[model samples]
Target: MERVRITDDGFTTLFSTEFNQYYHSVRGALDETQRVYIELGLLAKMQETNEINILEIGFGTGLNALVTALEAQKNNLTVQYTTLEPFPISEEDVSSLNYQTGAETDLLQKLHHVKWHENIEISPNFSLQKVNCTLQEFKTSQLFDVVYYDAFAPSSQPELWTVETFTHVASFLKKGGFLTTYCSKTVVRRAMEQAGFKVEKHIGIWGKREVVRAIKL
Candidate 1:
């Protein structure tokens, strides 16, 4: 099994024989998760729905999950989250994540060490379950309101970002559900479009000029 090492920007970096490019970079990691997944995608969906169910791909270091949970509490929204990670970091590796200090400290700790593979209730408004399995094999009976497609870049993990995988995810979304990703590749955009999604380009953070977001109709 490969190990996840911490990056200077306080994020985890995993090297998979599968995807190659350091998995994640801390400097841009939180920005991407918070901006694209939590703020823009998940929180936006909560405005109209009382209960929001979110599915996140590549649950690296639990950053996205943690952000979503905290956002739910702060915004007075109820969220049930499920994440799929094929190669999860060990608990000790998670503890090593250098999360930001001050107001983010307590939640950072909880997010770092929350038990894996079980539906753990982190707060009144938030609960999460993680599956340490490949995305290809993970299945759920329930449809979701939001999907955070936080996989590696298409240049790294082509299969995860491919049309086949997204098509599978598309089937799991309820009408009008949205999937947000940091990829802006034309091939990926085309893939999302072919998967029965209405694709749109959105401005991205962290020097990322553009990102692709898809809605299932």
Candidate 2:
């Protein structure tokens, strides 16, 4: 079972008693996604091409995908977003989220309502394909331009942070593609480097001191 907690930054986040962790930062969930994933990962590459392909490591509450979809619609950018999640949250939890306001709540609902394992056009420019599987079990011939590495923390799920896993995930990226994550540990950076990514640390959001952006060079 999951519970909701209002963080210091005035946003609601899901707390998983199973993992003993929150799905997003305790400071703020919406702010974190916008700062780390949309601003740094998606918008940074928006000017380079009109169409962008994005892969998210953990779909979780679909917050990252929702913001990306809104941005895509706003900027008239075409986006192909593919996300992987082994276990999805319940609809009750999704409905209880306080992320959006007024009419925007409808958009959030539609995001979660879309069926998995098939491509769904969220808007004229944004398309989503939610894969109901873990990264270890996910396989695809398609290459992505950006990867949102939003998995659980290394302390909780150490296996997902291994060099072999990063290398395998990196194989799905096109040349010059980048992966961003909230983790900035030296060991995690080194693992990304060993997996053939040129790693760089950037100022993090809210509670985090720094984040990493790794490029496939």
Question: For residues 1-217, what per-residue lDDT tens digits would candidate 1 score against the true structure?
Answer: 4556655555665555656655555456667677788766887787788699999888876778777777787788899888888877666766666654465677756755666778888889988887878889988888989999888787777788778988999888988998998777888988888888999888887655687679997
Rate residue 57 of model 1 by lDDT.
89
TM-score of 1: 0.86
State each model's CA lDDT, in order. 0.78, 0.89
Off by over 4 Å in 1: 1-18, 25-27, 104-109, 112-116, 206-208
Question: Against the true structure, candidate 1 has what lDDT?
Answer: 0.78
TM-score of each: 0.86, 0.96
Looking at model 2, the pairs that clash are none
Instruction: Using TM-score, give the best candidate's number.
Output: 2
Give model 2's TM-score versus the native structure.
0.96
Q: Tens digit of lDDT per residue, candidate 2, span 10-62?
A: 87889877677899988878888988898789989886997999999999888
